[model samples]
Target chain A: MKAKKQAASIAANAGAWLITAISLVPFLLILLNSFKDSLGASEMNLKLPGLPLQLTNFLVVVEKGKLLTSFFNSCIYSVASVFLCTVFASMASYVFSRNRSKINRILYLYMVLGITMPVNYVALTKVMMLFHLNNSRLGIVLLYTAMQLPFSIFLIHGFVAKLPVELDEAAVIDGCSPMRLFVSVILPLLKPAIATVVVLTFLNTWNEFVSPLYFLSSSTKWPMTLSVYNFFGMYFKDWNLVCADIFLTSLPVILVYLLGQKYIVSGMTAGAVKG
Target chain B: MNKNKIYPMWFAVLALLIYSVLFVLPGLIGIGYSFTDWSSYSNQLHFVGLENFKTVFSADENYLKIIKNTLVFTLGTTIIKNILGLALAVLLTKSIRLLNFHRGVMFLPSVLSTLILGMIFTSILNPSSGLLNTFLREIGLGGLAKPWLTSPHYAFKSVMAVDIWRGTGYIMTILIAGILSISQDYYEACSIDGASSWQKFRFITLPLLLPTLATTTVLNVIYGLKVFDMIYALTNGGPGKATTEVLYTAVFKKFGTGQYAIGTALSSVMFVFMVVIGFFMIRMMTKDEVQE
Candidate 1:
């Protein structure tokens, strides 16, 4: 019986190793080929060091793709949208929590619909055109913020409800105005919910595809994802440079995940549990 | 008290306006337009009841194939994600020293953009010099190597495989959270009864993990239905449309050709389908929750 259990354990370990290998192999391929010349990398040989590794492919991709500008655009979209989502969600959540009115309840339910329904991009494109917000970065940011608000509100609402009402009462009795109370007392205490919102929104916005695809017409204004798409189309033959570009585009998010895996993992699990 | 009532309204005003105008309004308008003849060439709006739907269903047999593909893609990915996710969750929760590291590595791909992953894999799966074929040849399985992205037979499965690969870790993490939440007392009780490993898993873990598994399955299904970016970036419904062509892709193509009304109709179909699926899933999950 003991031997049988040991064999089963060994099988499990082997299975785990196989999964890890499969998961890592693509990334490994990209990393190794990114250093080789275009032909050498495309040859798909894994054994030898494609020796004398240099930064040529990376440099070319950066220069040609204007990686810095697209990176900045991604950062702008993510940061601005996350800020919008958090501020609006926090305020709305605070209100929803504080008020038990029929209107608030109905609005909360209305907001929850966004979680299940796919965004109507056809009409969205038309509306953006009507408002001259189409084909612009700000338009995408606004839309991203709007798209994310429902889930953010849902998350922050639950968190806000748990804060004791006594805190609000105390602040009010201490002569704090409603706005000032929310600003000074409530916002600071919403740190955990805010972290979740930030991580969730940032990742969503950073990796957003459809919004930018429809909204941003100009190549210069493209986020890294869109730029990468266009880059793939333009340089489909140059596997080495393409690998370099892929690595460049993916590196920042990977770095962020490595740095704050806890926040991301917690936020995601929190979302799943609530969802 | 009056201030409390009014302030809440004030705080909600901005979010409501933006959401209503940008999200809800557009959705409603899209649904409305789905029944009208609102193509780019048409100057006047005409009510074309059921015409778009008919065309979607019968005009070319391609639509049927698309529907089939979408269902296959959805059901395929959903099942694979939940199964693999549960397996990983069960295995990784063991007393492995590098458990956290493995979990992190598994999840790393989930964080990357599907578009980027698609583009990366496009080259990696190329027929002639792709790493996959190269590896297959090296391992004496050259017979299995084929044009992964471009082949009609392999493209859909390839796309689904990539989707499952990227998504399983996410489901695993969620399941891990669920499994971790299961009290040790239950396992201890089972062990004291001399329950075999298979018996313990089947009787204890499976029952407790049902709700989480349900959650993952529903999430996967919903995501699968809305799949666009990865397919767009990878195959783009190519190799002569052999890969899975979902509703969103159909709608996208309709709009590309200035078929606004038809595109809107396709989207409406997608929306209704999703809502129905979501309703049933919620009902099923809630019932399971109540039973638990």
Candidate 2:
């Protein structure tokens, strides 16, 4: 029985290692090919580079794809949208949680509609036309905020429910107005939940493709994902540049995930476990 | 300031106004436009009741195939994703070294843009000189290798595979939370009752996980129905449209072709379909939650 158990343990360890390697292999493939020359990469089948690293692919891809500009656009979209989403969502969540009026319930249900509604891009386009926001970054940002509000509000409401009402009472007793209480007391206590909101909003905004693709028309204003499509179109035959562009586009998201890995896992699972 | 006298309705109204302007009004207008003959070609508009719908539903127009494809893609990906996610969650939950590192690596794909993932996988799955084919030949399985994204038979499956790769981590993360949240006492009790590992999992883990499973499955179904970027990037509904075209992709194509009314009509249909399904799902899940 002891020997059998030992054998089973060894098998389990080996299996785990295999799964881990499978998870890492695609990323490693991209990393290595990002540095390989056209002919070398095409011939070599995802193997590590032979000797002297060829930095030409990265340079060529950057110049040809205008990766820096794309990166800047992505940053603007992600940062602005995340900031707006977090603020509005947190405020709405606070209101919904504290107020028990019928209006609050109705509003809560209305917000939840956004979560269930299939993103009507056609309708959104018409709306954008009406607002004269066609092909504008602000247009895309506003749409993202409206779309993301439902989930963010849900998460913040869950967190706000657990907070003690005494904090609100004490702030009022100290002559703090509602807005001041929210900023000075409530917001600080809701840091963890706010952090979760920021992380999720930032990640989603950064990785978003469809809205930007439809809304933004100018090549110069294209986000990283759209730029990848442009690169593919411009260099339809050049596999090397395409691979390099893919690597550059994916690098920031991967870096962010590595840095905020803990928060993302926790934020994603928080509601699942509790509710 | 009278706290009770102060109404929060004003703030709620502000949010409602923004939402109505940006989301609800457009959807309502879209439904109206679907009935009218609207397009970029002419300023003249006519009320063409059910004409667009008829054209869409025509058998010769390939709309039905698109709908079928959408359903297949959704059902296929949702099942595969949830199953794989559940399996991985179970494996990772065992006390293993470097577990956090493994978790990070697994979740990497989920964070990257779908368009980027689609492009990267396209290269990897290329027919000539792609890594997939080369690896197959090296391992003496070259016969199994094909132009994954180009072939009609394999294109849809290829898109589904990449989606599964990209999404399994998310579902796994959720399922892990669900599994972990179950009290340790249950597992200990099962052991004391002479329950085998499989028996314990079947009796305890599966039952406790039903709610999470329901939530994840519903979310996956919605995602599957609305898939766009992956399909667009991977195959573009090509190779004779062997892959599922789905309504959204069709709308994109129609808009790209400057067929605004037809495209909006397709979008309208999708909106209604999604709303109906989403309502049913939420109702069912919440009802189950209450019962539990």
Candidate 3:
């Protein structure tokens, strides 16, 4: 009986390891191919490079794709969108939490609707044309902000509601205005939730593909994702270059994840639980 | 009461204005456009009534298939993701070293862009010289090697596998949070009473984690309905549209083909579908929450 139990334990452990390897293989293959030449990548060897690493694919992808311009464009959209969305969400969440009126409840429902509503680009295009938002970075940013605001507000409101009402009471007694109170007292207290919103908005805005694909017609104004797609379309047969482009496109997100892993993990789990 | 309320009602009004203009107004306009015979070719727009919906529902066999595919994809992904997520969460929560590393590895794909991941998988799943097939052949299991994305029977399955791979970690992390919140005293008592791991899991863990499961499942359902990037990148709804196209892709195709009104109509159907489904799910989940 002991021997059988031990054998089962060993088998379980091995199974777990096997699953992990399987999970990691796709990523590992991409990583390996990113360093190989076109011929080598076409062969799709699971093994590491047998020859010296070639920088040519990376260079070609960068040059052909005009990656630097697209990277900068992505930065503009991501930063502006995240900043605006976080500020608006935090402010809206604050007001919605403090006021327990019919309007607040209705607004809360309205915001929740945003989460369910898909971005109706076909319809939005008419509005965009009306506002001349089509094919513009500003236009995309506004749409993103509008789309993200609901979730951010929902997340922030959950945290805000739990906060002690005493803080607001005391601040009010001390003659603090609502704006002042929110900025000084409530805002400081809402750091973790704000951090959560900022990271999420940042990630979503940075990696957004569909909006950019539709709204931004000019290649000069395309974000990294659209740029990567264009690169692949233009270089359909160039697997090596395509892999290189993929690596470049993913670098910023991977870097952000590594740097803000703690905050991202906590924020995600918190949002999940409270949301 | 008045003195504390410095921002006044207009601030709320302002926020509402942005919400209405950006989100609500667009959705309403979308419904309106769905009724018209609008397109890029002509500015003389005319109301087409339910013609577009009729076309979508009856004109093309693919539309119905897409809807079915969307349902399957969403149901399949949500069920599998949550189950696996819960199981993994329970296992990883055990007293194991390198738990953090394993957690990080699992969560890695969630952080990467779907477009990039799609490109990577496209190469990896290629049949002629793809890593997956190459490995299969080397192991003398070459029969299992198949053109994953190209084969109609396996295309949707392939897309779902990639999605599961990307999403399971997220669900796992959420479940872990749920599991960790359960106090250990119950588990300790169970162990003292000679309750086996499976019994403790089935009784204590399962019931306690219901709320989290409900919330996570609703979120997954919303995500599943809106799936576009991964499918768009993976197969572009190709291999003769064998994989699930869903409403979003249908709308996209119509828009791309310059049938703007029809596309907006398809989108309207999606809007109504999502709203109905989303309302039902939220109500169900919140009712459960109240019970809990």
B1-292: candidate 2 lDDT, tens digit per residue: 4543332444445455656677777777888888888877888889999999999889988887888899898999999999999988888888777877777778777887777777777777889877788889889999989989888888888888889988998899889889988999999998999998899889999999988887788888888888888888888888785465777788888877767788888878878887787666645533422110
DockQ of each: 0.53, 0.51, 0.52
- Which candidate would rank higher by DockQ, 2 or 3? 3
Error of 3 at A52 (Å): 2.7
Candidate 3 lDDT, A154-224, residue by residue in tens:
77877787787788888888998888888999899899888878888888888899888778888999999
lDDT of 3: 0.81
What digit string (tens of lDDT, one per residue) describes model 3 on residues B233-271?
Answer: 889887775465777777788889899987888777778
| TM-score of candidate 3 to 2 decimals | 0.94
**Pairs that collide, model 1:** none
Which parts of model 3 have CA positions greater than 4 angstroms off?
A: A1-13, B10-15, B280-292
Model 2 per-residue lDDT tens digits across residues A200-233: 8888887788888778989888888888898888
Estimate every model's Cα lDDT from 0 to 1. 0.82, 0.78, 0.81
Using lDDT as the measure, the top candidate is 1
A1-275 in candidate 1: lDDT tens per residue?
A: 89987888888778888898888878887788788887787664564545788579999999988898999999999899999989988998788767757787678767766766787788778799998889887888889999999878877877777787788888888888888988999999999889888887888888899888877888888999988778878987887888888899888788878777887887776545533
Pairs with steric clashes in candidate 3 = none
Query: What TM-score does each of the candidates earn?
Result: 0.94, 0.94, 0.94
